[model samples]
Target: MLSIKTFKPYYVKEEGNYIRVVLAFQYFSLLMDDKVYQFVPLESREIRINRETQAIENKDAVFVFQKGKKYNRITLRDLMCVKDFQDHLSKILSPYMILTQPKEKRDEIDYVIMELEKINLLRLIDLALDEKDQIKFNLYTEKLLEIQ
Candidate 1:
């Protein structure tokens, strides 16, 4: 039997008004199961360590969740155990690289990515200013201006 031992999030970040949580899973398959499956966190790569800041900038490193009434009580485990959760995780985790994808599909992904970057930049600018860090605040402002 397949069973989940634990579900832990490695990293969580905010983009605009949404929360993106990156989860690492540990599972097991009992002796009766025909196929054994296991996830050993210590033996594998740290999901966030290999990723760079651009993972957030380009919006591909974590699963995005909107902040609102409906999803308020949901836990990381709840999300992970939901039906078709792997499909949802697959969609979020896939590296939708522009060069490798089909020509026709590239445009849509590129446009969405560019737009997400802009929004993320604006959010960073807001945070910098709020924290009174003139250097980063000014830097983000300049980047946004350049984008315009």
Candidate 2:
């Protein structure tokens, strides 16, 4: 689709990946990079990733929860795997780029990634397999990813 509404400068998205966005796609109308940008809206997706290895969880969600750098996870049971909310996570997560410092000669990119994740709530909340809101939570994660 059309990029953003306006042409903004460049921001380092991933470690070496930089994005020169026209409008910042965030959760709100926050002026990202000194220019206005709207987030892609909040949606969830069951991101498959291993917490310990920080890799995609390739096994099955049925196994016991292994403690690691896990994001909010829920077992997919039914159609409620993905849902939408007005409180799109982008609302809380879009400001992460502000924390990213220009790639320095002495700094490693990995450090910035870990630090930036602090701004995302999905990176925090955790629900047990049998938690009351497990289904709802999984669906939330799925929806968020779809939007992202």
Candidate 3:
């Protein structure tokens, strides 16, 4: 029987309208006929999935497996027939498929947060000055300097 022993994406990348997932030998393995076979990428380790369709785009991508120096190559499509394999793969890839803000948007959010922190600190510093709290004033000033 064929079964998944380990399946974890080595890294995920967003490419245009697809998510490219790379799998390395160490991250993916299969158990077949009571023997474990580690997946080794022969030419390409990339598995591309359409963002809209969620279907694997590189079904012909080849992977190699070795057993005591004997190597075997198989296409990704061949593994799809294994029971629940697609379901398990979908589950593992789901986390990586969630939409994330682009770098520019993330940077904008960080800038806004920093500005708010600066504004809040300035108000606290003013309050400290009014109350004649030298220790609080010094602390807020130090924090403001660090932020800048």
- Quantify all predictions' global Cα lDDT against the true fold: 0.47, 0.33, 0.84
Report the poorest 10 consecutive residues by lDDT, candidate 1: 64-73
Cα lDDT tens digits, model 2, 48-108, are 3222333323223321111233222223231113232112322322453234355683276
Evaluation by TM-score, superior candidate among 2 and 3: 3
Which candidate has the top score in TM-score?
3
Best by lDDT: 3
Instruction: Assess candidate 1 and give its lDDT.
Output: 0.47
lDDT of 1 by residue, 1-148 (tens): 3233333445555444334544543322111134333333333212331132223332232222222221112233443455454454445444432224567798998888889989999999889988999999989989988877
| Residue 33's lDDT in candidate 3 | 79
What TM-score fits each model? 0.31, 0.16, 0.61
Looking at model 1, the pairs that clash are none
Count clashes in each candidate, considering only residues at least 3 apart in sequence or on different chains.
Answer: 0, 20, 0
lDDT for residue 29 in candidate 1, whole number 0-100: 16
lDDT of 3 by residue, 118-144 (tens): 999999999999999999999999999
